[model samples]
Target: MEINTFRESNQFTYSWHAIGAGLLASFVGFASTFTLIVQALINAGATQQQAATGLMAVSIAMGLAGILLSFKYRMPVSVAWSTPGAALLLGLGVVKGGFSTTTGALIMAAFMLTLAGLWKPLSRAINKIPSGIANAMLAGIILNLCVAPVHALAAYPLYIAPVLIVWLIMLKIKRMLAIPAAAITTLAVIYFTAKVGNIHAGDIMPHFILVKPEFTFSGFISIAVPLFIVTMASQNIPGMAVLSVNGYKPDAAPLFTSTGVSSLFAAPFGGPAIGLAAITAAICAGEEAGADPGKRYWAGIVCGVAYLFYGLAAGAATRFISISPPVLIEAVAGLALMGALGNSLMNALSDKENRDATVITFLITIGGHAFFGIGGAFWGLVAGLAMTFFLRQRQLKAA
Candidate 1:
């Protein structure tokens, strides 16, 4: 009776704190990367309309997935579209089959992810992939975009200056605000100098556009496989780690299944894979969310609600990117991904015994070559595995 009374007494306080945490997490996550999502889709042959559709689709998919997972498990399990996966798309030169082909790839990848949840063996095999190779593949995928700020500075000094200055200042004040601040700064620069062009009523309101999926071998090897590997290795697994670090122990498979299913539904409308969130997971699951860990599920729920609102802003985000200088947004993306690149490189190089193979993987992936319709990402993984295997075999023989 006393415990129940105490719980009722603190419910209001808990609710407000959780709501605040959720809003903060959603704002930071969405503001920091929505441009990346829009620009990447366009880079991969999406028309502005298709890109906007994709943004809305992904935001809604992830938002719903986060809400469902949090409520069902009673844990703070925030969901997000794969950032590394988007980076990989940016690296992919326009595929032959265009956005519809990319849509087909999305379906296949999401299917595999959903299957992994249902089939233990597949999940274990995916888990068996070495972290170094996975991280290196990711680092390679993001390398070009991560260097865009330097290029932007060299090309458009006047335009890039305020964005970088604001980002650095925010970094000193509060790290969480840095990227979002830079994003906002970029918006101001766009407003004054570029003046977002040709924006209409349709551009301000989000809509659902059904893209016909086109299956091709190139699409499968280039888009589907790489997207699967990075989303699994970089986003989903690391998200689980963040939750674990926060002392939340929701079963991994169910969470994967739920997000995978959500991705499947969203793909025909141009969404990429939705998975567990790593950075935002930390925000929603952290102590700031609530005093009682058990009640933190409310944070995830609120984040999902917030993302649904962000989805409504998808058309506007697409318009901003369409008119703004490409290099400028790419610079913002580069800054946004600096932490990810550094983290991946650190992880890839940490395994001293595998360091050489890891380097090989990074070089091949960053080379961005294609052979027989297969892209550099797949070749890099293969080469890295071969190097690791040869080294291991030689060691066993010597011993």
Candidate 2:
């Protein structure tokens, strides 16, 4: 009887561990990127109300998706709005067509994602996209944002130094915690230094706003295509790999389909894109969540619940970001994305044979050199692929 009681007690501990892990995962995920999401939306031409609504919608979508996947699969299958996708938006900046057009682009991208799940050929084609080119494009998209710290340091050293210093300290101790630590530090900086006019009661709770989408060829090619590519290459594919590594391999089709479908629901509300997570998913699926792998679903469920709460409280986050000095929030965001940029550069330049093509892609993207209304991301991929094909043909002729 004592042995049995001990087993039950042990199981109880594991359950709580899962719960705690889930909350941490959700908090980290939200705090780390919520500001970026808002910034990206505003850059894409969303008004403050629309940007905050986008955050709320995406946060809720992420929560609901996590809950659905975890409960059904009995695993810690975490979901998140695409960080890289948001970065792509930031890189693209305000398109010619405006926020409604960006919304249309997002809806189209979500549709393509859903199709990728349902259609085997499309999925295979997307998966087969050269890692070097894809990574190079991602590296290019985020390259500028990654450098925001240097500029921010020069501009607001007094206010930003403490945040960067604390982030640096945490980076050595706990890499994952570093960004959130920076975010918290920024909150402190904002609270004490910045003059944010009175945050009314309504400012603490975000309200949903419907966005009417307008689709155009320019928006579709510039925003939708690149958004889908990054979300798939950087987030969705790696997200599945993370779960597989953690010994929880659910069907990728459902993951894609569900997130894509969920994104459709959120896009009208200005959500950029949604997909499975790469980093935070590992947290919820790892053994740290629970010893019993089967019970790790609790972590996912709790993470989802926490996301719902964050969604409701998104207005306060937006309020702080709004009052922040220009380049200040980007500084926090840049610090947060350093790790991703590092990984992307490593992957993009890893292959000696592909270095030439990869460099073309990276330079064009990072340079933000565009052609005829299209953005650098679209042109970078094109130029990279062309260079890759031409070089391969030359090699074949020589051989």
Q: Highest TM-score: which candidate?
A: 1
For candidate 1, list the clashing residue pairs, or say none: none
Candidate 1: C-alpha lDDT: 0.87
Candidate 1 residue lDDT tens string, 1-399: 011111344333446677788999999989998888888889888989899999999999899888877766777789999888888888895888788888999899999889878887887888888889888989999999999999999999999999999999999999999999999999999888875566778677888999999988888888888888888888889899988887776678888888889989888988888888989999998888977776787899999999999999999888887888898899999999999999999999997888999999999999999999788998999899899999999999999
Residues 304-351 of candidate 2: C-alpha lDDT, one tens digit per residue: 999999998777888778888859888888887888899999999996
Error of 1 at 399 (Å): 1.7
What is the lDDT, from 0 to 100, of the residue 244 in candidate 1?
84
TM-score of 2: 0.95
Q: List the residue pairs that clash in candidate 2.
A: none
Superposition error at 138 for model 1 (Å): 0.6
